[model samples]
Target: MFVFTPTPGTTWNLTVDNFTQALHRREGDEAYIHTHADAEGSYGPRDEHDWWFAFSATGESWAGTGSPAAGDHEGVALDEATAGAAAEFAAWVLRELVPPGAGMEYNTRVGMESGLPDEVLTENTVTELDAVFRKHLKASSS
Candidate 1:
């Protein structure tokens, strides 16, 4: 799974399996689902192409061309404000990625973790999730 904070108030969570299945169903291509882990203790698995992108708190961004292992999965540590923004992004992603004919099976655990700062986990969290997903899709494509 890939996790990140697209903006100050948003957390993005994504799984390779879910993404691959959704893309296959929508684009009818299976290449997007093809990825493998290179390192044993990595947070997320590395793709054969070794492409990985991550956003850090120090305003640092990382992307490279090397295989990553499943243990390489990383989480987006967010504050209350940022978490809220992430929820909105997640909602946008759901709207765009979830196809009309696609069933709930394609749904993924793409959301913030519970026990977050109450201020961030407000009623709008769902919206943030959608927005986060939208941002992720855009970034992944580009």
Candidate 2:
């Protein structure tokens, strides 16, 4: 699991295994990846806005916004089990999550506000990653 807050108004939580399950359900295979976007509410500066994307492995490897007929957002299930699909998805996330030149700004802001080292922030983000994923799983399963 991994969590990242690229902007004040958005956060992302990703899980490698549950994502695998979702991908399996979507693609009818065990070795595939999935990506999805969720509309989550924002607080602070961007209060009342909807922004957030949570991607998990489901058996697909495509990307898009909003919900799809299969589910929400976009996903793609690759034919091969190579890391290329995951790498491409991650690259897309890195590009989409935070715009260029804003990384430093957000880092400084969050650093000062939290009064924690970058390592701690990274750890917290990762912790929240699985937490959110599990919550979603529980909800869907029920």
Candidate 3:
């Protein structure tokens, strides 16, 4: 049991720093919160964020804040808010499947991708992933 969802590439209605700060404040024992953004944002404009950063969870519980791995960008094409809306929809399906009292139990040091949605998602697994996001981006859409 236990399934997980991943965060979508949504442009939070906040400045980059503000978003980062907000994520820092978002910690809880209730669930795992994976937060990330374009790493290129650190070197370039606020809009041309292409470098992907996978972050790890620090302390107990996922606080949506952590340090990215040494490298950046997994080359996984994403649909951010300014881009396509697939991530938004994938997030929706996973959220709809979540039941009460669901949250991630494991703390991971490895970052990049969350093994979620499996090949097929079920309500049973959805409730188990804890508070996963973007639970369906990697699914087989055939």
The prediction achieving the highest lDDT against the true structure is 1
The local distance difference test score of model 1 is 0.34
Models 1 onward score TM values of 0.26, 0.23, 0.23
For each candidate, what is the lDDT? 0.34, 0.32, 0.28
In angstroms, the error of model 3 at 60 is 13
Model 3 per-residue lDDT tens digits across residues 77-142: 222221013223223323442234432122122212453222322323423332233333323121
Q: Which runs of model 1 end up more than 4 angstroms from their true locations?
A: 1-34, 39-43, 46-81, 101-142
Candidate 2 per-residue C-alpha lDDT over 51-108 given as tens digits, one digit per residue, 9 for 90 to 100 = 2232333344433222222333222222222233333343434444334433311112
Which candidate tops TM-score?
Answer: 1
Q: What tens digits encode model 1's per-residue C-alpha lDDT throughout 1-142?
A: 2333222333233444544453345446323332455467364433343333222212332222212223243122222224333443334334443334321111112322322221222223465455644554444445
lDDT of 3 at 24: 42
Stronger candidate by lDDT (2 vs 3): 2
The true-versus-predicted C-alpha distance at residue 127 of model 1, in Å, is: 6.3
Q: 130 in model 3: Cα distance from truth in Å? A: 6.7
User: How many backbone clashes does every candidate have?
Assistant: 45, 16, 8
Q: What is the lDDT of residue 73 in candidate 2?
A: 22
